[model samples]
Target: MSPQRLRDDLVKQTKIDVLTADQAKDNEAHMHTVSRSFLTDTITVPTPEMMSYAALSSLGDAVYHEAATDALEKHMARLTGKEAALFLPSGTMSNQIAIRTHLTQPPHSIVCDARTHIHKYEAGGAAFHSQAAVIPIHPANGHHITLEEIIHNADLTSDIHFALTKLIVLENTLNGTIFPQDEILRIAKFAKENDLKLHLDGARIWHVAAELAIPLEELVSPFDSVSICFSKGLGAPIGTCLMGPAAFINKARWLRKLFGGGMRQTGFLSASAAYAVSNNFEKLFHVHELTRRIEKGLIELGAEILSPAETCMVFYDPAPLGLEYAEILERAAKLPDPITLGGSRLVCHIQTSDQAVADFLALISQLKEEKKAEGWVPPEKTHVNGNGVIRDVYVRPKAIH
Candidate 1:
């Protein structure tokens, strides 16, 4: 289907005036000024088609327990191509449960990228919930940690006073980097030889599948356990699934309840996930294309686009224009129409499009070209290179530290 046709269908299905208010409010809390019409997500709601699935989204209290577990088990089993899957309200819960289940012994350590979501974004949930110490390895560039690094670190593993290596957690499409199947196979072999349980944080696995032209199951097959998120790029309202051994998920269900992640009649939410799995998968490809277009545009404009446009994220450190982070974010939030970004986090989802891409490019051009006086160099702007003499030029400005 054409993107325009799908958007029209979504319009009939979604209620633009009402469905998007909540999102705007949510965005407002974070300093965003947006109208409902600008959103691309169908779940942004008031859409009639999305409402048709109310039967699926509305689960009774007892059903929340049964359906949540059922959804988790069903999807996860398919994900790892494994025995079971468990549902949790948040990825943090699923990850914590995975860690706790793997670390049956005390003082066990989890090896993961230093920028792993579990380490960088999930607060100290691993420490507070699992009580396990993290062994972090930074990716040489972006979030793509090398398989050789995993092996070197794991082979040098020890049972000394320090925590014993218990689990190897990898975020596929690390921070913003995506790994190929060959890399997964290599790391999985190393993980197996050393007897460490491997976990794949497939938060953006769906995005990777679209980008790499690989099946989700094939992409995640090497890991012993896999955690998948429906909310990120999949555009589900909320939910994450943890797939592993049936026995492991059996324990996970209880852990989810303990963490207050259990919901009643969760098939309502899972139904959206089901819709995403069935109908929404293709849109991710559009997101990938749009991201490439935007990143390329940025580069063409002389901004240093970060590498690994592997999935949905496009990270750039715009120098010279290195203004205050707060000011940069503030500008992003207030952009009039067909634009947004307020959080300093630039990401693309299924709803993002070429129009949005063009809008963002135009705004960036404006931001980059604005100068205090004539020419490109603004007196306030400054950058220092290897040479002692710092030169000023017109370029994308990244926030200074």
Candidate 2:
């Protein structure tokens, strides 16, 4: 089926009520969104109070300004213990810029886990922008790559036949589990020994540091460059920061412009990112706790917990309960305040409340019980059948690059 036709079928079959941001805000009490990675509509959309604050703050200039853009960069650099930082439009840009900056000249390669955002989700951007190849290593558990795996894939031999391994990239909270610090340190040591640059896709690093109860700087110390998302788990509407050495960041700035990421009067956005750094950073712990609560509820419902609840994400397979993906999704759409299926991943963030979690679980329980009573058999072939049993859902709001 065509994409638009499929969407039409879903809406018609489920009678799902899709709400705009304004509509969601108006219906906040009824809305329960467990799949969003940041604050829900109520917090994400600016309020009159927020507008008033922004009015008092310094306005951004046509070019990157000292007060807003520069200050945010410096603040992120300080927090991550890097010599410099550059604020970019998105995490993808930051990661790609780091790739371009590190690889410099082509015929280069970057080694990363098969599931890293750069390899899986970024639309082959490293190849397109940096003219570099990606060497993906799949870990047995599908969560994180081991140091041994990196060693196996590094392929640092000086053979002209192979792309020179210029960088090793790792991700924190790759599948909602914190990438172990010892492993990171080992990889860093190996990268140093082999003269390869190290970059970290720390998009949700805030959750990792909060869960580890460690300072953010400590977690980022091993990598030569780190990209952090203010928009994910941090509750900022948009913005990502890339931190590294001063010279590296200077090059990244030029790359950002080349990538068309330079924005004039961006302080409005930077101010929100600044707000997230100061205010929302610490609230990540509570979000993780809520995720744990949701995980426990799903466990009680006989859903398979695919991974341990570490940060604000919960991954699971709902098939064990004999529930059809379509049926569950359709049921969700029928709720008083409907929630669309977020693939298979449920993510909790600042706006997801304890009550929202409870309500979601209750809905699941109701579906399971109804299925049991009716002896309902899922259709032999359904929309999600070919997609695999395990669902990996990460909520990132769509934003312009």
Candidate 3:
């Protein structure tokens, strides 16, 4: 289907009236109990009937090793136009396996936008796995690296006195804008000429593919390797896939095992992943439209919306800080506190609806309109203990002045 059509139809919205008042209340009540950390992404576990084809594949725990991997390999290879593909436990593992396989040449380096997930998160696994330097390029605002930026930094004079840029990675729908094909093509051409491997961190590749109206295969064929996560917007509970030449995939499989990713019967996760790829993806395109709705809603309220919501993420910095960060942190740290859901760092996903959006807006509105006469009790109100100051007594809840 055309990306535009998919976007229009896949996220086809149900009218607010279709939901009974009780159902709406139930959803909000559910959200109250749900942890905000889990709400930060679209990867909530599915319900029992969420596309589970028990008749076709009843072995819940079976990883469908031969079948699932074969399906995964074929799916990835067809999508990437690569010779082979393999599955890993997580996107982290998938990217790690690919990097380890390609960075065989010592002193090899990867060039990426500094805002990449691999750099910020993952707890430094790249160094432990590959022992290679990851050179940071123009990494900002989700760090999208451009072609000219590459040509400007690349060493055409000689390979020595520089980390051989073995890999160049680009993320799509990066900071909510898909890279124009010309840019991707230019980088691919640059990589080819410089003997560099082009890897695509296509965790959310569907957004780019759906936005550009290009089949993923056509868009990703130039990449030497690609890592796609099923658990992100794809809505799967777990699993990630890496695509590349058959030889490269064979090497990745072995490394996956070495990383303790080899599972006895992971079909449970794979099954869930397969179901997510087919059914959940249609919902992702709709998120784009929903984001537009939120952006417009926030803007109309006279709030300075930081930037328009493109995909599922929309961040807005609240003004005149209704509450301090430290207070929010301390309050949030209290175990089982439902107020954490009201954190400034809001996120949206499939479970969220228009009414829920309204409630969140209302919550934020209430938070901002109120005033406080004082901050948290200073150390002056507390007594010093051996290692820490102790509150002498509970400071009465400051009345909203």
Candidate 4:
């Protein structure tokens, strides 16, 4: 089937409702979103409330100024205990700038976990922009990468045949599991001993810090460079900061301009980030509590959780429930307090409320009871590829976008 047709079939089978104009307006107030990284869909574009807050700000910056952008950079620098920081347009830009800045010479490589954002989600931008190859270390448990594993993959020899490894990139809260503190310290020592620059893909570092009750600065003090997204879990609309040494940030600033990340009058966005750093950072602990509530409820309803809830993300396998993916989503959408399920991964953010989570748990409980009464048979695994090919492939929840 064509891709569009497959989407149509999935929507139809799932009974996904497209809201009309009036319904959409009502949804603005009552809809419960369980699978988003940001505060809400309304926050994607600035709402009137956001605008009002942004309007209560000072004048904007031209290229670089000391008011908003400078304050934000300084705030992040202090939070991460780095010498300097630069605000970039997106996490991708921040991460790539760090990669390119670290690997100054060609034929350099970066060692990271196999499922890292740079390895899996950055669209090969590391190689495209930095001309660096990535050596991904796949963990046996498929959660956290140990220092031993990282050392096993490290190739620091100055051989002409192999690409020189210049950096070791680590991701905290990779798929909601915090990289252990001792492991992180061990890796940092290893990187220093091996003459490898350590970079942290700390897109969700806020979540990790909150989970461990560790201050952000202490958490990221080991790495040479760190990329953090204010937009994700921090409730900022759009902004990411690359924090590192003064010289490293100076190089990254030039690269940011080259990559079209330099922006004018960005105080409007930075002001929001500043607000989030002060306001929303503490709320992540509560969000994780809500996530655990959902996870515990789901397990009671016979859902097989794929991983333990660590921060704001939960992964589960729904295949054992004897239901197709589309059907599972259909039941979820048809609930009285309807939910918009995103495959098998459910994420909680600042806006995910206790009542919303309770409603979702109720919906799952209802489905489980219905399934027991119906004696439904397990269906063959039906999967759709990116190109719309139908195959008997099992679907797993994807990492946070």
Candidate 5:
């Protein structure tokens, strides 16, 4: 084909508009929906003010160290009291990269809390990316893991019979329960004496600081490396920063490229994250308060609080009221102003409205009344599935029609 004809064809195929004619109205509706959602904080959308500010960011390529990206990294490094920081697309990448960078040799293992995102939700990235074995340990107290548990489970031998434990990972606000800082210090001391590296999956570490009024530097000081996300409770559109010593982050920056996480023109994304830290950090306190309200409401309606709102999430069991999560999910969606839920986890975010909390409690109260009218009784024993695992009752929404 002639050059002119090829150019014309490419233009014709690429020139298409994604926006609807009523884009403004649609966006307004979406904002309203997000305000009422208790599904997860990751669903929270960026505000127009944040987007407007992002538009003016430097248009530099991130692989070559973009200006805004560099600034954000520096700010995060200072904020977390680390020597340096590197930005990645998601918290998972930040975490996996940290793991890959820390474990240079094979036949190694990482000791972590049983309910950590690294082990449960990262799709086996530690094993896949670094070829490292994971030792997941449950805490006896049922909240945060203790130093004794780490000492008991960690493989510290060099008998060539077991994978040597080189790293210890912990999560802040795992299931919305803050990992006690005092315990973290104790573990940190153990890690130091044993020459083991300590890392933190601090995606919601902002919540710990917000709830307890602790400084970020002090909160993360115990860990050798820490990954903090801006998208979850802080409501940034995208990006997470992995902070550590200058050498560790420098190596992680290279691995970030090898993992195909390097981006071009990341100035806008960095600016959005910076805005989240500046504008949305204080808002997390309100999110935690809202979460506590949901916990209190569920308790008043006779639901069992499996996990209280230590931060921005609460896990409750409605079995005490003879209600299943599936029924509650269906009923809440059918309300005049619908509220969204995800199984037992109710995560309140910066955009969550007071009215949403009130509506959620109202729905639970109504469901309790309906169950009473139908002569439903709470089971003497907890509901168990065929596999003998107690059911939490997560259900996908059926067709509306």
Candidate 6:
């Protein structure tokens, strides 16, 4: 084939217009949906102002330590009072990289809460990347793991049969409940004495600071490394910063490349995260307030508050109203202006509208009345174990006709 013909074919394949005529309209509708979504904070979209600011960022290869990316890393390090930070594409990557960086050999394990993202949601990245076993301890207090639990469960022994606990991981605002700072300090002290590295999956740690009125540095100071996310609750499009000692981050940067996460021209992405750090952190107060409003409304309408609005999330059971999650979900999706829900976990974000919260409460009120009229009886109230049932309900889209 002729060079010109080959070139023409390639150009034709690449020259496709991704945008449809109604793309703007669709995006507006999407924004409206996100404003009402009670699913997860990760669904929050980037704002025009944020994108515009990001567009003006320096266009440099991040593999070479791009100026914007480097600035973001340094800023995160300063905020968390760490020596350095590494910007990665997701919280999972940051976490797995941290684990891989912390552990050096086989016959090792990392201890963490049973419900932590690292243990349950990271697709076993620790075992895959670090060849480490995860010791998931169910917190006896039903709130946060205590130092006693760690001491009891952690395999600190050099027994040939078991992997020695080399690292301890903690998640602040696990299921929207903040880990007690006092407990964390005790655990940190224990970890230090035992020569175990402590890491934090601080994906929603911003919520902890905003709700508790704590400084970021003080909140993260106990851990050797903390992975703070920009995407969840902070409203950035994508990115998580892994903060730790300078030497540790340098090694993490190399592992990031080995993990195929090293990206080029990441200035725009870093700038967006910087914007979130600067502007959106304060907005979490409003998010928390909105979450509290939902909890309050649910309690008033006779819904069981499974988890209180300690931060930007609340888990509730509709059984008290003689209703099921499916009933509310069906009614919510049918709203004139539809509100999205993911079952028990109602996560409020920077984009979550006050009206959305109101509308959700109104839906519950309406459904409660309907059930009462239909002679539906509330079931016998039993203590629902916080860790027993999976909280979040997954919804699939119906055919649009």
Q: If scored against the real structure, what TM-score would every candidate get?
A: 0.79, 0.83, 0.74, 0.84, 0.94, 0.94
At residue 259, candidate 1 shows an lDDT of 81
Poorly placed runs, candidate 1 (over 4 Å): 1-47, 56-72, 141-143, 155-159, 320-328, 342-344, 378-401
Instruction: Assess each prediction's global lDDT (C-alpha) against the native.
Output: 0.68, 0.79, 0.64, 0.79, 0.92, 0.90
Number of the top-ranking candidate, with lDDT as the measure: 5
Candidate 4 stretches greater than 4 Å from native = 1-50, 377-401
Candidate 5 per-residue C-alpha lDDT over 1-401 given as tens digits, one digit per residue, 9 for 90 to 100:
99999999999999989999999899999999999998889988989999999999999999996999999999999999999999999999999999999998989999999789999889999999999999999887889899999999999998798999999999997988998888999999999999999999999999999889999999999999999999988999999999999999989999999999989999999999999999999998888889899998898888988878999988888878888888999999999999998888888999999999999999999999999999997665556987698854533332111
If ranked by lDDT, best first, what sequence of candidates would result? Answer: 5, 6, 4, 2, 1, 3
Model 4 scores a C-alpha lDDT of: 0.79
Query: What lDDT tens digits, residue by residue, belong to model 4 across residues 251-363?
Result: 99988889998888887888888877777889898989988988898787766788878898787776556554567677767766666666667777877767767777776
When 3 and 4 are scored with lDDT, the better candidate is: 4
Give every collision pair in model 3: 11-286, 62-267, 63-266, 63-267, 114-139, 140-143
lDDT-better candidate, 2 vs 6: 6
The runs of at least 3 residues in candidate 3 whose Cα sits more than 4 Å from the true structure, single-residue gaps closed, are 1-39, 54-65, 139-143, 155-160, 175-177, 320-345, 371-401
lDDT of 6 at 338: 94
Error of 6 at 112 (Å): 0.7
lDDT of 6 by residue, 145-165 (tens): 899999999998878999999
Model with the higher lDDT, candidate 2 or 3: 2
True-structure RMSD for candidate 6: 4.4
**CA lDDT for candidate 2:** 0.79
Q: How much does each candidate deviate from the true structure in C-alpha RMSD? A: 10.4, 10.3, 14.6, 10.6, 4.2, 4.4
* lDDT (Cα, 0-100) at 267 in candidate 1: 63
> Candidate 2 — which residues are off by over 4 angstroms?
1-44, 47-49, 62-64, 376-401
